[model samples]
Target: MRYTLFFFLLLLSACLQAQYKINLQINAPKDSIAYLRGVVFDDKNYFPKDTIRIKKNVVILQSKKPIVGGMYYVQLDKSKQRFYFILENNDNLSLEIRGGEIHSNNPRNQVYFQYQKLAKSFEVIDSLYDAEVGRGRKFSYSDKAAFFKVKTAALAAFRKKALPKLNPSEVLHIYFSALNRLDASVPDKKNYAARLAFLKGLDFNTNKLLFIPTYKELVSEYMGYYPTQADSLLKGVDQILSRVNCQSKSYPYVLNYFVQLMRNRNVQNNTEGFVKFVNTYVEKSSCNALSATVKKTLIDDAARLNKVVNLAKSPAISLPDTTGVTQDLHQFAASFDYTLLAFYAPTCDHCQKEVPEMDSTMKLIESRLNLSLGRFYVCNEPGVPQATWRKFISDYKITTNAKHVELPSVSDIRTQYDAFSNPVFFLLNRAGEIVARRISPNTLRKYFAEIQRQRMAQNP
Candidate 1:
């Protein structure tokens, strides 16, 4: 009797060791369409209720309770079909496929065949698209007509089947691909225009996938080739901007693009229109803070241009001097035919190299013409210990001719000037208006010459 009891205990231990135990529970609405739970074994699907024995790397899932050994599959009521899988103990495993067949469990031969077919299709379609777009035809159908035909058919197939179901990211890919196809060599304006019109009509608000790239493309095209289409482009942009509700995330990119377009394009003929558009949009925009800042920037920029236009008639200056001492910019302006306001940092390498060059130029121009140079240190390392500030000043020998002063409000100065980088130079006339600004050492000489010419013309 003692031997038989011992044998029974050993048998129980062996049975428990062979079984892969799993616990499952359902915590979803009863009206769910479908629910399933399974474990992955060597990338194969294993239902918890199945009788087939699973090997290593096996996952076990169930619909109701714990399942002991072999894999098993469970189907809850079609309605309220949600289910979850749980591991009972520390089992080396991963879970997948709550509702469908595990693709990896397909026989290795079938997997190989599917992959080969996919690769061939991808290669053919990719080649056709590239050839069609790359053909140096003035018109779409002029060169590589055969390739274009193939590409069109393939694209249509993709759009009809995939576009409706595509997520935002996928839609963006399609839009970008279409844009890439619109090249300078393509003579087919009608086709390109139609494509763009279609993209413009896409529901960017509900599907954010194609919004940014589409906006960018429209901006580029407007600036590059379609100045005549400004009204239409602006309308499209207004619609897009309305949908971008997240200011902190989206405003910078959109604003930067607008600023670039305004700066690069000669939109003066449409200045009134542009200004009205900005004012109306700014008033309606959710980007109140950004809008205010941009408006100020635009106003200041316009004011500067007005000063330049009135350079000969009204030359006046009111900028602050070093030591926070207010000086009539006109004082330095009239004394020197050309004045350079050097914004620099003592520790900046570019400043170190630039200051001496500026000093040499000042010396060269001083005798032949009335020229003055004043340096502003733009103390970037503000609030440092006094000793550190003094040491930095001394190390750079900044006192030679330049005046040193801490910015009255460093934050304000940075924001006002947009001074993210160091060693900036601004050229001013007798009117204290900025004639030019330079960041590169190479460009400084050219700007200086231009300023000198302008001054001579004014004085002559």
Candidate 2:
């Protein structure tokens, strides 16, 4: 009888561990569609985890499997507005979202939404200030004095009220949100700096929080807030590496985070940071600290990034143009006085807008001088459909005068050019050397104009 009772208890525990309940209610139009997206990594890339069809304006995301604790978003259709929440403890969690407001049983999400409400209120004050300026009226000191007083009081109240009661997980979410706040347009930098300093000193870098999706994000934003110069940036990377245990799983995760960040911005001397990081840490001792795959990726990415810094000879690539005829990039580029080597993707909305602007500007530049600018539009490796690419070209009315090539199978294309996003532009001279890389099309026009003026000055 004792042994049978023990087995029954064990089975009950197993059944309890295997299930989770997540409930969501959104006050939107009936029959609206909403998706529950899981946030992966600090980059906050969302993947659709579950879908809900709103019936009578409510849907329960019931699951028999345990839901992992992380950040998640509830997105409606294709709208820009998204409701974000943190899942903790993963038992009987409930969220009720109405319009832009979120109500939840979770205290962490409640504090987050409260803060959002305060921020929205502040935006109203900001719009009033903007309206004053728009009318060509001189902003009086009295106008902002009231706003500043209220803003200061409200922030102090919120921080004092919300922060002390939070668990480590909840505190980390607030820290992540605060770190990502825009500092460029803030009216009071001194007060903001103090808040940031307090946040930076928090006890966040623990082994327990390492697996949390927002952990590295907090660290990344904290590091980014400082380190305005290249040397400082290099030291910042070293500091992060030294802080985390190399044996821990977070070591490689954090390493990959910084590597990808630098890779995305790897143009001109910006590539120096990534190169130096690899060289410093690529020794057998340090390399052994990382997983085999991560070490290999670091070595391979460094090698490719090293080859294409400003003034480096462009790497040789063979790819078929939109016409299906294979062409050598280096040989073809040699024929033009300058080649605007653009790496883009069809799915990028920003690329969709910018490519046409580039086409228009280049057309205007072509008529001015014998310096014919050839457009080499290289589609980066994303496996976007050929039909989508063709449709994009037709929709944008992209110049048929350019060579359009899709290199989806070429893994080196991303590493070689550091094409982390679409609409990356590289300017190559007749000798197939990169003159300027990752600048806007308007900036490219100014660059060419400067060169033209300099040539006329030198020759005359």
lDDT (CA) per prediction: 0.44, 0.66
Tell how far residue 254 is off in model 1, in angstroms: 3.4
Counted clashes in each candidate structure: 13, 0
Task: Supply candidate 2's per-residue lDDT for 256.
Answer: 71
lDDT of 2 at 135: 83
Candidate 1 clashes: the total is 13
Put down candidate 2 lDDT per residue, 26-66, tens digits, no spaces: 78763377888866555354456787776544454554565
Q: Mark the regions of model 1 whose C-alpha exceeds 4 Å error after superposition.
A: 1-173, 179-280, 284-335, 342-377, 385-404, 408-426, 431-460
Once fitted onto the true fold, the runs of candidate 2 whose alpha carbons sit more than 4 angstroms away are 1-156, 164-204, 207-217, 220-232, 265-267, 270-273, 281-291, 308-339, 343-354, 357-425, 437-460
RMSD of 2: 9.4
TM-score of each: 0.35, 0.53
Best by TM-score: 2
- TM-score for candidate 1: 0.35
10 residues in a row with least lDDT, candidate 1:
101-110
